[model samples]
Target: MSQPKKTFNDLKKDIIDNQICTSCGTCEAVCPVNAIELKNTIPNLIGNCIECGICYANCPSASFDADDMDQKVFGRTRKPIEKLTGIYQKAYQAKTTQEDIHSKAQDGGVVTALLTQFLNEGGDAVIVADLEEDKIWVPKPKVAKTREEVIKAAGTKYTPSPALVGVKQAVKIEKLEKIAVVGTTCQMRGLSLATDGPLKNKKIADAVALKIGLFCMETFNYDDYMQYLKDNDVDPGQVTKFEIKNGRFYAWNGEERLHRAKLANVKPLIRSTCSHCTDFTSEYSDISVGNVGSPAGHSTVIVRNEKGQKILDAAIKSGLIEAILIEDFDKEETLVHKLAEMKKSSHQ
Candidate 1:
């Protein structure tokens, strides 16, 4: 006889209770009965259960087929030497040509530029993390359909938002035909789970058109982080931007650095779930972008597949962005590799 089917209770026991849930909202977004919802950083079951087990089956923290996902998305598994940057066709130092985006972007504005161009070219929507309720630090998932919308969502929020939920909104609620995603490493892995292997969700597989993933060290514990800021005499509302650079976290008001923290001092504030995740550069993404391994005004971009190459090339050809080989690569150690190595080793 067949074994009993697993359900949300199984997810709770295996992932939530163990504190291994990545808070990607994979269960919330893919739930057939709309039974699951994420409140802050925790997942709760609110509606009647259908016992479909999609939530249990698709949660990245619970079940991720890296080799299968790699083979399906890239036509091969990542080689042993490809541990840090994963599989990529090319790597570049890139910056956006759009002045407006450059002004608001955390670093290079390459992500905003590419998404804007894609939307202009008839892409349906982009699901991105946006600041919620005029708060500088609280990010919420958004479905952006135009250039202005995409621009507003530009910049990195150190906290984690369940961005995958926007996929559900984009595909099911809005009935969008083509969708692109801009998210962190865990979120990218969440996408990989939905589009590849035995637990594949056809809705996501058919709709998602691009993946633009950010480099991440970890997601913060919101309460702990807010307390740290309060103790430092920094009010979250006064901050104009939040930045993480060279092992330091900065709260900035335009050109003024309002407050700063050494990464180690804030280690206690990092979410416990992040300790279980090893992906630092969003290796599952078609294109990954980050501030490391590039010049001050540019982002280091990893193009992993034909689709990523096509978009990056088109962005350059359209004068929306410019690119060059990473500077001084032959002269020094690559920062991206070092961080990737650190995160993987420590997390494991």
Candidate 2:
């Protein structure tokens, strides 16, 4: 009575068969020897794979076996609290005005608020994406000490950003004690996959003490977003405020302004992979934060785990956030509205 040995190929087969792979490209990025390539929405494992198990370990969809084991061993199985629940409304201190954080943020200042709290409390680092010289998005996992740096990194990236690229670097280089990560739903799920199984990379998972997930409707490809700017006579260089407001997009570049355009008007340029996605909130995250149904300048906070609640409580105590209770948040209806928007935009 011995357990069967698992091989890399076996793992690969399971991943392909499951059809759960979002193709975030973490496996390709983590391979020490440059063995994996993303081809046709799937990973083409090429080159010399030493079967380091990085690919198998990083595949988010490879958790079927683990889920099964959890059910068998624990007598019952459960997903992370974040995933099981859709959304929750909680109040936070509004010490910083929406204008202060909003002006610096992409849309709402929720991302900046969460990151600032972690950094002020002596958290090691914050992982985020920044605009690059070549117009390509790059991951920057900074060891931030000041609120200024944290604010600088806060904003929404509407592109298919490689947010997970910094996970490995955070583990090996900074030797961080605690790190707060912000990402969309797919990226959070990818991180979740990296934490489980025999091939778990402890450095990446253990260092991530706080997971702040942003609500994602759909992430457009970089080209599509750029084209959206162009079609609307927007100059990428002159762009100031880019926001999704009231089911429409508003762009302000210094004195010039654009308004009342549905996201569907920019449909030709969206990423194809986004259409197949179903998760709007990063279910695996400890807390999911967004501005979906809240007042124009306020953030909607959903605390899903004990860690999330504790972090939020500490932030409030430190006078970093203001709290307010949402009377009724129609989670399902909101999701339906978002989905319909995505579909309408895609068709356009």
lDDT of 2 by residue, 146-220 (tens): 677777766665665555665655655657768877888777767666654445566676788887887777766
- Clashes per prediction? 0, 11
Model 1 lDDT tens row, 255-282: 9999888988888988888998888889
lDDT, candidate 2, equals 0.62
Q: What is the Cα root-mean-square deviation between model 1 and the actual structure?
A: 1.9
> In order, what lDDT does every prediction score?
0.86, 0.62
Off-target runs (Cα >4 Å) in candidate 2 are 1-25, 28-47, 61-95, 133-145, 254-256, 330-348
Candidate 1 residues lying further than 4 Å off, grouped into runs, are 1-3, 134-136, 327-333
RMSD of candidate 2 to the true fold? Answer: 5.3
